[model samples]
Target: MLPGEFVAFIAALMAVNALGVDLMLPALADIGRQLGVTTANHRQWIITAYMLGFGAGQLVYGPLADRFGRRPILLVTLLGFVAASIFAASSQTFAALLGARVLQGLMSASTRVLAVAIVRDQFSGRQMARTLSVAQMIFFLVPIMAPTLGQLLLVTLGPWRYIFYALACFAAFVLAWSFIRLGETLPVERRRALSLHTLAHAYRLTLTNRFSLGYAVAASMTFGGIIAFVSSAQQIFVDEFGAGDRFTYLFAACAFSMGIASFANSRLVERLGTRLISQAAVLALIALSVAHIAVILSGVETLWSYMAFQALSMTCIGLCGSNFGAMAMEPVGQIAGTASSIQGFITSVGAVIVGSLIGQSYNGTTLPLAIGYLGIGLAVLTVVLVVEQGKLFHARQAA
Candidate 1:
């Protein structure tokens, strides 16, 4: 990464993005109540709506970054995101809120996919992974503090709308800072032509890369599974466990445990390599999910106990994220922007499938959650195994 000063800028940029996702958790319940989210399952759209906007717009950003350069593209999207957040905060109905959230998601996706492209534009392979890991570690602090911060806003201001107002101010700060320091990574000579032919070429290259697709699909499945929980967490904890006002702190604690794993993985990934760490972590998550399912079956399940394994499962997710992302970005260094677009599309497709499972089924039991996690875990394990060696346990030996 850069020195502390520039690194903090990147981290702050990333922190603003993190705030977009994690801050909503504290207010999820209140949002449900205020908007007549009458069913436990209905509330998931609060998060789902955002992801729908966020992931779908990434396809546009890839071309934008490649053609226009990253700096101007990023600033424009941040401003759009700020506008959407304002609309979201002012919405008086679920439909309006959902629309605003979708708009916010579309604009904010530039912050995400473009940021990755910026990092990739500067470096590749191990160096890129290390930089991303460092960025992620620093950015991870946002989720840890964000829920607590959101909770404060909800309690003191007596409404969730204030959180959106604050996000607008945060976005303005990031835009000003980004405008000053976020230089264009893609120079004029290096620009990819904005055309269907170029897009097709990028897609062909990305599709043909076995290593890149394997990791992308793995990361997609992993994130899909995790977001199912995120979408359902408010309902599960508040309605099922009566966590209520303390839910944000508890959620933050769980989030901290997850972020901690990424820091640990950062120390090991270079030595172990991206492929090794991700392969191993995927298996570990499968094992943990199997064990957790067994425990639930044996009737020892409760909120406290669930948190233990859940935290561990989330740790697997954290380890997989930075490593798998680096793995996907490893071979596609030539077309990082477009490759990221493809990756975002693939992952978002999985998210819609996975998020819908969590959203549509709200039985007020962990069985649904357990079944989803275990099934997805096993499915990912199978996919990775098949992709690697045509058989399980031969992942490390493949290629």
Candidate 2:
């Protein structure tokens, strides 16, 4: 594959995960109503369960990918994802749907882990960060478009299950594309043996490295804020702000800002360095969160104001995400698969728990969400400080 194709393929792989979540947003209310769910907050479990499974599943895929190879493991998982999506579409009960979603998420975990591992196989430091940012910029389009697609489907197809079917078809297309075009990134000599001892050593190396673990934790905290917003976005936009059908467009606007920020980061990361850019972004996030909360408290929050603040916050998140992940993986290049798995597990599971708490705390107001963002920003900053030993904005030469 050409450089552009590789980057786009990577983005397409990651976009599968984004589509699974975002495409369901418009159908959340319909699913709840049809499934006899009355509580608004409980509908969040549709997303939380998949994320939990996605996180837990990562622990195994990394080790397996390290032992076998990226290509085989990814192909198998994509097939599983297709089957799981079909199962979800066929669900007759809410529990059955959740079960299928967990299965789907478990299969989807391979995509997230292996995408990072594949990139890590080729790049490091600032280059890796730039590559990831570019890929993420493209991946952001799914979130920007998915809700609108979901709404369109609901308007035309008249059933929530069709979204699952659509997901299955998309995954199948990706699976075919991957099989025909994607090659194994991990070389034979670089592959680890499939042994308990090897797995333990790899995991220990990942965890024992303070830089890797700290950045992973910090990234997880940042992800929690994102998930919190996504899980509650429908309610906040449609129910609280009365945006109605415009919710999808509003959500897309925030996603577009993140996409633009990601593109900017990709272009600037090599010159400015990951540490400087990510640190400044985190600080900006904290300040934005504080101001957003103040506006909420002042009783002056409007849909437009909320959208503007969220767009800015999402931009900060976009800048922080790729850089943080690149830094975490920088120190664990040899164990990229395992390291990616560990970090992916931490980020996904932690985000789900944190996001779920904030989503469940919805009281027909934006205060809880704003407070959650503030807490997340502070927590991320604290973790980064400990990891860097109170250092900030330190530049490193490209590896």
Candidate 3:
């Protein structure tokens, strides 16, 4: 693949995960009703279940990808994802659907882990960060349109299950494309031995690196806020603000704002450096979260008012997330696959646990999410500060 095609392909691969989540947002209520979900908050288990499985599966894929090769592992996982999606679509109960979704998430983990591994196989430092930002900029389109597309599919197809059917079809198409176009990025000479010692050593190397481990934790905390919003977005928009059918469009606008921020980060990271851009974004997020909470507490918040702050907050996350991931991987390039998997596992699993708590705390208002954002922002900043040794906004001289 050419450079542009490579970026688009990676973006598409990562977008599959986004599609799995965002596409379900519009259909959540329908699924709940059909599956006899008893409580309003309990419906969030659909997302939490998948995320938990997604995170747990990452623990193995990195080692397997290192041992086998990116291409074969990805193909197998994609096939599994397709099968699981089909099963999910035919679910007879809430428990059945949740189980299928978890299976699907387990399968989907390979796409995320290998995508990063493949990129790290080529680039490092700010260049890798730049590439990821660009990929994410394109990838944001999935979130921008997914909910709307889900709403459309739900309306026309008249069944929430059709959403999973559509996902399976899309996964199949991507699988074919990847098989045809993506060659093994990790060559034999660079491949790690398939041994427990090798895997354990890689994990130790990754975990022992302060930069890698610290930023991974920081990124997970920051991501917790985003996931919190995602889990509760439909409720906040439809139930609290009465946006109703317009919910997807408003959701898209928030996603679009993140896309814009990602595009800007792509341009600015190389020039301004990831450290500077990310730190600025995090501080901005803290301020935005505080203001957002005040607005909600005053009982004067409107839909647009909530959206504007949410979009700004998501933009901050976009800036911080790419930077944090790249920085975490910077010192662990030799063990890229295992390192990627470990970091991914921590971030995804941690985010899911925390995000779920925040989601379940929802009470017909934005207070939980807003406060969650503030708490997460503070936590992320503290982690970043410790990682940087109290340095703030200082770019590396070469970067």
User: What TM-score would you give candidate 2 relative to the actual structure?
Assistant: 0.99
Off by over 4 Å in 3: 397-399
Instruction: Give all candidates' CA lDDT scores.
Output: 0.78, 0.91, 0.91
How high a TM-score does candidate 3 get? 0.98
Residue range 204-312, candidate 1, lDDT tens digits: 8887887678777877778877677777777778888888877777777777766787787767766666667776777888788888888888988888877887788
Clash count list over all predictions: 0, 0, 0
In candidate 2, what are the lDDT values of residues 1-399, reduced to their tens digit? 899999999999999899988999999999999988889988888988899889999998998988888999999999999999999999988899999989999999999999999999989998999999999999999999999999999999989999999999999998998899998899899999989899889889999998889888888888888788899999999999999989999999988988999999999999898888889999999999899999999999998889999999999988889888999999999999999999999989988988898889999998998898888888888998898898887765662
Q: Which residue pairs in candidate 1 have backbone atoms (N, alpha carbon, C) closer than 3 angstroms, thus clashing? A: none
Each model's TM-score?
0.94, 0.99, 0.98
Query: Residues 74-102, candidate 3, lDDT per residue (tens digit)?
Result: 99999999999999999999999999989
Q: After superposition, how far is residue 373 of candidate 2 from its true place, in Å?
A: 0.8
User: lDDT (0-100) at residue 360 of candidate 2?
Assistant: 90
Backbone clashes in candidate 3 total: 0
Report the CA-based lDDT of candidate 3 relative to the real structure: 0.91
